[model samples]
Every structure is written in structure tokens, then in C-alpha cells.
Target: MDAVFVIKLSALGDLVQADGALRDIREHHRHAIITVMTTPPYLRYMQRCPWVDLVFVDPRASRFNLVALSVLRRRLHKQHIDLVYDLQQVGRTRFYKRWLFPNGSWVGDVPGCSCYLKRPKGAAAADHFAHHLRQAGVSVCHTLVGNVGWMADDVTSLMRQAELQPGFVLLIPGASAEHQEKRWPHFAELARHLLDRGYRVVTVPGPADLAVCRAIPGDMLVPDDGYYDLFVLAGLAAQARFVVGNDTGPTHIAAHLRKPGLALFGGHVSALSTGLQHTCFSWLEADDLHKLPFAKVWQQVEQLMGKDF
Candidate 1:
């Protein structure tokens, strides 16, 4: 089987987007082996996804590390990888492509600000990458492919351990980095309102956002390190009556899973970057979720939960 290597290292949302590109490869070249190289944390996410036949983990070392580069090169050579798709398209990705497959074609974002302008509105990041793939002779459906298969068994076990019950509202109160801006003031009020409404508000915070969860008063369910995998998180999201969060990875994952969700977006992140098509709602800057009263969010949550009131 001829192999193609897709390199996308970190950031869960970006990695999730790569799943679409992988789907494109599979749809177009069913016989070819499609492998992805990402960070270790994302391995479990990729493991359960059927689009990828193999996964390679890039080490923690700097991309400029000669030893690491040599190892990566040797691995690609051993696998007889015919093509390299640099989804990341960072300086390191360019370096890796130059060393490993100097003669191979590299497909990724065009240079500079042009990349941002190329992305279409309401299109998921994966759709943007798939468009680039088409230019490279790989044709794929324009539709976005969501995450594959349920880690239901894993999620059930985690929920059991946490004593989480059905009809609980899942609240994710943080984003990965500082600039992302978590709408905590709104979330705090939202959490209290949901708790009052007879729904258990479970707070799931990533490592960086633990402080936000700690601030939410009441018994909250935070995933132990064991269930940190995105797929497992998606399964957990599926179990929720509704998910409320900022424009973060887990929120995107929840939306991708078609979980009833309300994504609160401050002026920073747009609906085009994070909104999901199905029952998902986006509170954009124009809507101003941060400034809106908790009652508004509660009303949206009620609508998603099918509560007539």
C-alpha cells in the first residue's frame, strides 16, 4: 500500500480539523495507506478514527533538532511514504519536508496573511484544508466529516467514577491559551441558573482552565488524567443534555459530535471558526453573550433540552 504522511502536531482543534483532510484522502484513494504524525496527547483521538491507517508521534524536541529530524526521516523512508502533506506548514514542517522528502510535493496553507483570507465563512478548518488538497489532485466532498465512533464504554466508565447522571448540563469554562478569553462571569451565572433549574452542572476544565472550574461552586465533574483523550471527551459530551462553553477545543469537539451546544463567542472568535451546523447555537460578538443576562443563555439551554418553559 502506498503511504501518505499528514503532519499536524498540536492544538486539539487543529488536529480535529485534520480528520477531514484524512477523510478526503480515504475517499479519493481508498487503496493508499494514510498515516498521520501528531503529538502524543492526540494519539488516542487518532487511534479510534478509521480514516488513518497509522499514526506517528513527533517528539517534544525542537523541530530544528537534527537527531529528531534524522529519526523522522528514517521512519518515513522505512515506511516508504510516497507523499508528505504538511498540514501545520510551520517553519519546522517546512524543514522536515525539505529533509525527508526533498523532491516530494508539499500541500499546506499559502504563505502569510493570504492563508487567513482563503478560508471561507461558515466552513470548518478541515474544509479549508480539503480545498487545498483538491488543488493537489485529491478530490473530496465539501461536507465536513465529524469525529468517528463513540468511546462510549470509556465515557460510561468515567461518568460512573464521577457519579455523573443523565440530563446534566456540561460546562467547559476555559480555552487553551490566554487570548481565547473564557466567558466565566457569564458561565458562573449560567451554572448557578442551571443548578437551580434541576440540572446538575458538571464542569469539565482542561489543565490550563482548572482555575475556572474551581471557581464554580458545587460538585463538578472534571475528567481525571486517564480520560483526557478527545474522543473520550466527545463521548462524554454526547451524554450531556446540553454543552455550554467558549470557542475551545472541547466545545468544537462537542459540536462536531452533534451534541446540543451553545457556544459563547466574545468579539474574538467568530462563528465561522467554531460553529457546528446541527442544533448548535453561536452567541457572537454582535449577540454579546458576555453582556447578555444569564436568563438569555438559560432560555437557549431550555430550548436545546426541549423544556417548554
Candidate 2:
């Protein structure tokens, strides 16, 4: 393929999960000019992505807007895209297939496309990514081993400025606003114990999480001026000795980076479905997070520490 397009948009955690899939695509089509059609929230990160050669903002405006659709069609046609990988695999992307690239070479769940790979109901995201790629004749090594090594920025100066050092235990005490139940209520208590044990606790909160994170006892890693971007968040997780957090985007980054950590989850989703757990990255699930106590989570932390305590 001379030109290719991969569709993935929105939500920070899902984008991080697609790291492995993106790498596999780039490696398989090394000679092709690969582009990612994403939303504005992820435009900056996609521009820095090592795998894709181009990034296009999918306006994702109302499908009924003829002017917007016309502009998108014209731009995509200019690329002369030879193949499209619809990783998004949602209603919006299916609409794109039917409207913009009606007959062009397309690969995804959409029926009647050049290549159709249906995701099994209730299949894990990582597994589904690998399955479809292998079905499409691409080697599927990295899709199951999500890696964000390339997405990190050097935080030496930032670390110094923040009066923190590497190897400190990282704590993520907040979840997305809509999923407040996902936030375990014991981080403050847990941080106190870590502090007593002489472990430096650190937290890097997103814009929406500053208030919640600041209340937790830790060396808060925020820009003195504005905010922390994806690279810096990955960098913090990359350098952390151990991570303890709710199931949020930063915790997913920690897991994929192969950091030794504990991700707490409620009954909303299973850890297996997210595929974020590993030998080093462990999880503890409860039917209700509010009832999950700090003692149990602390025990998991001690276990992650490998009897060094």
C-alpha cells in the first residue's frame, strides 16, 4: 500500500491501549505512508507518534453536516489512500466507510469492505486487535504487549524542579469524573503508610484531577504554569519505582510501560477485559470500591515490593 489510514479517536486510556496495535501496523507497512485520523484532543500526541507519518483531525461533527463531510471527503481523497484500518470500529467509523470511502480498500468490522474482521463479542481489546491483524496477514507480536517507550519525554529537569527523584512510589488517586466509583477512597491513608515507610510518594494529576490529587499527601508533579501532557505523564510512570492507582489512563500507561504496580478496579469492568495486568502490574477488584479497605491494598503493595520490606 502506498498510502494508509488508521482510525482511532478519543478517550486517553483507549489511545494508550492502541500503542501496540499502532506499532504493529507501522512495522508491517514500513514502506507505506501511514496516517492516523483522530480527534483534536489527541492531535498533539499523534503528531509525536513514531509510527504514523501524518495526523488528520476528524472533525467528528454532525454526520448531517454536508459541508463538513464534503471537506473530509476531499481531504481524504487527496491522500489517495490505498487501505484503511478501522481500529475505531464504532458507529462513527462505519459511517465513514459508507459515506467517504464507499468502495476503497477498507479493513475492519464493516461488512462488504475489502477485508472484514469481526471482533468476537466480549473479547478483550488487545486480543481483538491481534486477532484481526493476524487475519489480515500482518505479523502480530506487539499488539498484545503494548509499549509506550517512545511516547515519554525526558523529565530530569522537570523532576529536579519538582524536588523529586526517580524510584519514588507514584500514586494516582482520582478517576474520570463520570466514573467516580472507580476511585478507591483509601489513597490518602495508603500514602500515609508509604510515607511512614520512608517511600517518597508522588502524583501527577490531569487538569480535571488537580483538586482531588492535591488533597492526597505526595510530591505533586504539575507544571508550575499550565499542565502535564501525555509525554510527561508517561515519563512519570516510566520512572516510578511502583505505581498505585485507580484504573485511569496514567495507570494504564504504567502497566504498558511494564512498571511494577497495583491497579484497583471496581465491578464496573474486569481487569482481564482491559488486559492491563501483567506479572509486575497487578490488580485488585471489588464489587464496590467504597467498601475496599486500605489494608488489603497495602498488602498488595508489599507483595509488589518483593519482600524487600
Deviating ranges (above 4 Å) for candidate 1: 60-64, 109-124, 137-139, 151-154, 157-165, 177-180, 217-219, 222-231, 275-281, 286-296, 299-309
TM-score of 1: 0.80
List all candidate RMSDs to the true structure.
4.1, 1.5
Per-residue lDDT tens digits of candidate 1, residues 17-58?
A: 565667777777688888888889888777767777888887
Consecutive 10-residue window with the lowest summed lDDT within model 2: 272-281
What lDDT score is found at residue 159 in candidate 1? 78
Task: Please give, for residues 112-166, the per-residue lDDT of candidate 2 as tens digits.
Answer: 9988988777677788889889988889988888887887889889888877878
Total clashing pairs for each candidate: 0, 0
**lDDT at position 40, candidate 1:** 92
| Pairs of residues at least 3 apart in sequence or in different chains that clash in candidate 1 | none
lDDT at residue 202 of model 2 (Cα atoms): 91
TM-score, per-candidate, Cα-based: 0.80, 0.96
